[model samples]
Target chain A: MKSKRILDALLAPMVAIIFSVVLASVILMLFGANPIETFSKMINYAATPRSISLILNSATTYYFSAVAVAIGFKMNLFNIGVNGQYRLATAVGALVAGALTFPGYISIPIVIFVSMLVGSLWAGIAAWLKVYRGVSEVISTIMLNFIAIGLIAYLLAPSMLGVQTAENVVGTPVIPESGRFPGFSIPGSQVPVYGMLFLAALLGFAYWFILNRTRFGFDLRSVGQSPSAAVASGVNVKRMTMYSMLLSGAVAGLVGLPLLLGAQYSFTVNFPGSYGFTGIAIALLGRNHPVGIAFGALLWAFLDVSSQILDLVGVPREIIVIMQGVIVLSVVIAYEITRRVKVRRQQDAVGKATAVAQ
Target chain B: MRRVIKIASVLFAGSLVLAACSSSDEAAVEENAAPVVKVGLAYDSGGRGDGTFNDAAAAGVDRAVAEFGVEVNEVEAADADGTPERAERLRLLASEGYNPVIAVGFAYSDALAEVAPEFPDTTFAIVDSVVDAPNVGSLIFAAEQGSFLVGTIAASASKSGKVGFIGGMEIDLIKAFQAGFEQGVKAVNPAATISVAYMGPAGDNSAWNAPDRAKTAVEGMIDKGVDIVYAAAGGSGLGMHQAIAAAGGSAKGYWGIGVDSDEYVLPARAEFKENIVTSMLKRVDTAVFDVIAGVVNGSPLTGIQNFDLSRGGVGYSSSNPVVSAFASVADGYAEKIKNGEITVSSTLTE
Candidate 1:
């Protein structure tokens, strides 16, 4: 039984990968592109030092975004507002940090604290609506995403928080040098690997530890499993929902810090948007597992980095996007099939034991 | 079971967003024999079919392809991908032997600055923004000079003595256009009230992409007795054109000034072309063609070569008949600008 569980775990992902590859190959041929050459080039690019650094940097942001969504997913909550939460948090965080001067330790933590506070507050509105007014989170969160974009659009203008930073660019003023993360070289790449990479990994560990080993985690998961039963067991399901939403928003606040601190040192009007949607995909891709999410973020990052090479090889770079969609769809289908198969085998094993005894 | 359905629905919505945003058409161009000079155009977030900035850049490359027979490989920058991804695009082009990699927009400033130093042998040129590298050639336009001509037309054609300027972003590049337009308006009519407003801050693509906002601003100005409206907004500039045409074109004495390419005759803007007065031609196509021509001719034009009015790199279109009435007045300023008699400053004094 133990070996079967292991096989099921490994087999599901492998099957998903093979299915996506076959589908992508057929599409590539229709576009007049050689699938073998395109895939080979992507693999080759992935092995490069520059590609390694780029993937790690992108993965850092993706991890924060994924974990934030995963927390909500565990409760069956569709926290589509991670984009809004992070943007609002980062913009406010940067604005506050840029407005003040402090040492590295003092200022960085304050910036992070402000980010979590703002992000939590942003998500709290949705939580309040869900618990009190019976508002569906999906609808409210989607609306909040637009509100967030409109808010950022207003805040980043010159009359408000914006300042001219480059020839044709305006952005928030630079954060204090000491307050910024001093990223280090990763050897073989001109671009330095973000120092926050370690933080993202630590976050993964903490998420695993807190969700698996703590009492609060127990009540949270129990409510997630069956809210009515948990309510009967003396768990305040409403409180648990509120707590998880806050925690998820807190995590979401850190999504932009890697790039904000490690590279740019300020929030430009062109501050990379759309990671919140990518997080949803990663959360689904990882199946809400800590280790699984780490691999998922890396794969998504890999696809982004590898696609750049496709254009150089005279192939449609969008082939990577197609492959990603296919992989995601297949994984969902593959996992469901595996779950049914495992259940049937367990019932069969129990039936044989009873028949022998009779 | 419900969870499965919910997940499927979310995936469907996500794919729809992807389909709407992705520009995957017009894939790869295969050239059998290696051409003498290979040009790789790294388009900004707008990509190929954006019908605004990237399309204008492609026009120059297309002309180069026909005349120089140079092989071209095109790559587009994805939205919100950050600077590293942009640098990677340039590096990929350079390492793969693309000689003169042309970055289409000012947003590529930081990315090109990083990658140009790594490939010292590769010749890189960026439009609109200046990158300080030995091999980098900044193809800047005297936008202020071109804008001055439109300002003249806007003032001469305006019977209400009210004009408006809508800038795409609050950046210096667009500001130059604003400054020239205001100066031209002031130069012609001292009593003219020129209201200026920007869509958003610089580096925000939405500043150029938000047509609804531009339309709203234009409507407000028109309600305030403004007869002429000029928009330097990028893709969404069409919305302002639409608003003007709907408000009653030449028949109602409403005139809209077009920017970048001559929008008077563009098929996309043809629906409202009759409403368009002379468009402020920045001549990006001419500059792009010249850079490519230099490479093929073995005399690559380097350094800060300002394509100004003297060389005919900047001017206005007289495609509309209404513009003919003010042609003599606009041409007088054009000659003055070309002869340095009427010096236009890129920076706005007021």
Candidate 2:
């Protein structure tokens, strides 16, 4: 029985991947390109040591973003505003860190702490609105995102928090080198692995441990499964909702730190966006499992990095986007089928045991 | 539930078997044919639709295709990962046997420097910045010289003593435009006041097409009694044209100076033609064409190819009849700039 459960868990994601590849082959053929040649070239190009580091760095950022979204998912809440939360937190934290000239140990933690605090506070507003004003979180969070963008735009002016550095670019003042996170060089590659990759690993472990081991985690799950049952069991549903949202936001805040401290050292106008939405997709694909999310993030990043080859082969790079969408859909369908099968098997086992007793 | 799972597993297995059983059909090779020279272009941020830089470069490629019958493949930078993606795109073009690869914009400076070394045989031409390499061509333009001519035109055309400059981003290249425009305005009318506003911060690609924000900026300038506005804001410049056209005071001599290509005759911008006095023609198309021509002729296309007033790389467009009246005067200044008798400041503070 134990081995069967493990087999089912492994089989579901595999089937989804196979289905996605077949669907993508059809798309490539439609575009008048050979799918076998394209996939072979992609695999060949992606296997390099340099490409591995690049993929790992991208995966590290995606992993954190996905974990943040998964926390909200566990409580049956959709936190779409991870985008705004992370950007605002990064901007504010980078601005503050730019003024300080402390050592790396002190300054890095301070930056991380401030980002988490700001992210939590921003998301706390949505939680408060939903709990007290009877507003749906989906609408409130989306509205808050636009408001945050406007506010950030206003603050980014030269007279405000922004400092113009080069022609066409205005951003927060530069953080001193002493306070920046130092990246480690990957063996046999020119690229360095992002220092915050360790932080992602730590956060992934914490996510799994908290959800499986803590009383608050149990309360959060109970509230998600059924609010009335949890109420009868004396769980504070409103409080659980607020806590889960805050936790989700705190994790989201760390999404940009890898780029900020390790790479850019300041929040430039070119700072990447849309990571929050990507996180939601990763969460759904992984079925909100911490270990599954790590693999999901890596796969997503791998496709993105490898798709540059298609551009050379006279094929548009958007084919990867189509394939990613198909994969997410197939995985969701496969998981549902697996769940139904498991339930039927458990019911049959119970009936057979009762017949033996009679 | 069990029945559904069984059906799903069967379907999944069936598809895999079908895919595996499919035989590979090899493409037939033809006899040796004439080897045609292929040119590759890697566009920055906004790519071809950007009415300013990239579009000008595309025009050059289009011209070459019409004239020389060469093949061209174009790639664009991915929005988020700028440097790595750019380098990869350049590398791919080189690997695919495209020679004399053209990378549009100064953003390709680092990418070209890295990738050009790896492909020592492929000729590379990068616009807006100089890269010191053996097989690389740096196509740069003297934007200030052209901008200075339009600045003079704007001052001459404005009824009010105030003119405005709306830039897409407050970067060095755009600042160079401001420097020349301000100097030209002040040179013609010493008492003229210039108001400058940028659309958004650096690194934000959306700023180039931010029409609504640009409209607000231009409207505010109009409210402040400015009768002339010069926009170097890419697609955002269209927003300024829309505002001026909708305001409809062109009969009172309220004018706009369009940047890059001639916006006066653009189909989408046809309604705003009357309001547009003259465009500061930054001939990126000419530069792009020149390099490809050099490659065909077996000439070394290396070092900085400067496009200034003398070489017709930059100038004032006389597409509108109303603006053509001052052409002789603009031409006189262009000759002086070409002769080194008049020098335009490339910096705002200068």
Candidate 3:
């Protein structure tokens, strides 16, 4: 039973991936390309060290976003505001850090603290509305996303935090060199692998350790499983909800750090939107497990990187778009089918054990 | 690994091309020296089909294809990953031996900065921004120079002194348009109030894509008794044209000045042709084609190559019948700018 439980966990994602590939193959066939040859070409393309490096860099970013979403998912609190939270956090973080030239030891910590604080406070608004005003967090968070956009827009004005450093760019001033984390470079790529890669790994381990080995995590999970049961067990449901939200938002704050510190050195106008929403899809794909989320991120990154080769091959980019959509849909579908079968199998086992006792 | 994939895909795609043509090159043995110039263009936010600057850049590639017979691979940027994705696109093109790759917008500045150093052998050209790399060429236009002419036309065509400027984002490039337009509006009428508003803030791609927001902004501008609107808002400028056309157009004394290529003639803007008084023409296609042509002739334009009024790289389009009445007046200012007698400020005073 233990081996079978593990098998089901592993087999589900595998089956979904295979299903997605088959669907993609049919689409490729319609496009007049041999799916096997195309996919094999992509596999060859992915083998390069440069491609691997880029995949890791992309996965590093996705991991932060997915983990942030997963935290709220684990608590049954849908904090859809992760996108707004991260964006606002980085904007404020960049504004402050961009203005001040301090030692790395001081400035780095300042950036991290400022980002988490702003992210936490922004998310706390929705939590506050939910707890006191009886407003649904879903509606509140979505609205806040737009509001956050407006707020960032205002801040990005030249009269405020914005400084035009290039022809078409208006962004916060560059972070002082002393404050930046000089990341290591990989072979065969000019772009440095982000120093935040180590930080993401640390975040993953901490997520696992805290959720499985800590008291707060247990209460949080209990509240997620059943509010009535948790209320009977002395868990403060509202407080737990607030805690989960704040924590999720804090993690979301780290999403932009990889780009900010590693590559661009500042948050510009095109700092990449929609990362927060992609996190939701990734978390679902990974089943919210830390390790699972890591693999899901890498796989998604792999698909993105391969699209470059696929672009060169003259395939319609929409075919890759379809494959991505299909994979996410299959993850959800396969998860449901396996979950039902598992529940029935457990029920059968319990019934047989009772019959043997009788 | 990448070389292997590129070669394999080329062969594979080549076979398909041969199959489709029916009578073309099945006698293929030119693998040693294909002799064709392969041009790679990576377009910015609006991509190829936006019918704005991107489409103008596409026109440049189309011209290069027609005149020089260069093989082209066009890649469009998705806004999701910003810098890294852009860098990867350039890297892919350069590594695949696309000798002279072109990035369509100023947004490619940072991406080119990173990728240019890596592919020292590949010549790169980016429009609207400069990167100080040995192998990279910067094709910058005097947009403000062009905008100044349109601004004079807007003031000349307007029944009311109140004019408006709508930018996609509050960035330096778009701001220069605002600056030049303001000067020209002031050049005509010093006391004229030029209402300036942008669709969104900088750093987000949606600023260029937000037509609804632009439409609302222009509606607000029209309500303020403004008679003419000039927009450098890329795809979102279509919203401005739509609004101006809907709000009584030239019949009600409302006009919109276009940007990049002539908006009056673009199929996408045909319905709004009556609304477009004139366009501030920035010949992006000419710049793109020039870069490709230079590479073909082995004199790749390197460093800050300014395309200005003197070079006829920037001008005012007299496509609308309304602009014909004001054409010579606008052209006089264009001549002065071309001679440096009338210098336009690229910086906004307000």
Highest-scoring model, TM-score: 3
**What would the per-residue lDDT of candidate 3 be over residues A117-145, giving only the tens digit for each residue?**
89889988988888878887768987888
Give me the displacement of residue A139 in model 3, in angstroms: 2.6
Where does candidate 2 clash, by residue pair?
Answer: A167-B171, A167-B172, A168-B170, A168-B171, A169-B202, A269-B203, A270-B203
Model 1 CA lDDT for position A171? 73
Task: Please provide, for model 2 over A12-77, each residue's C-alpha lDDT reduced to its tens digit, 9 standing for 90 to 100.
Answer: 788878888898899889978899999998888788876787788888888988998888878877
Q: B190-257, model 1: which lDDT tens digit per residue? A: 89999887887544556778788988898999899998999998876877887787788778999899
lDDT of 3 at B273: 87
Clashing pairs in 3: A269-B203, A270-B203
State the lDDT at A30 in candidate 3. Answer: 83
Task: Give the least accurate 10-residue stretch of model 2 chain A, judged by summed lDDT.
Answer: A162-171
TM-score of chain A of each: 0.94, 0.95, 0.95
Q: Quick one: best DockQ, which candidate?
A: 1
Candidate 1 to truth, TM:
0.87
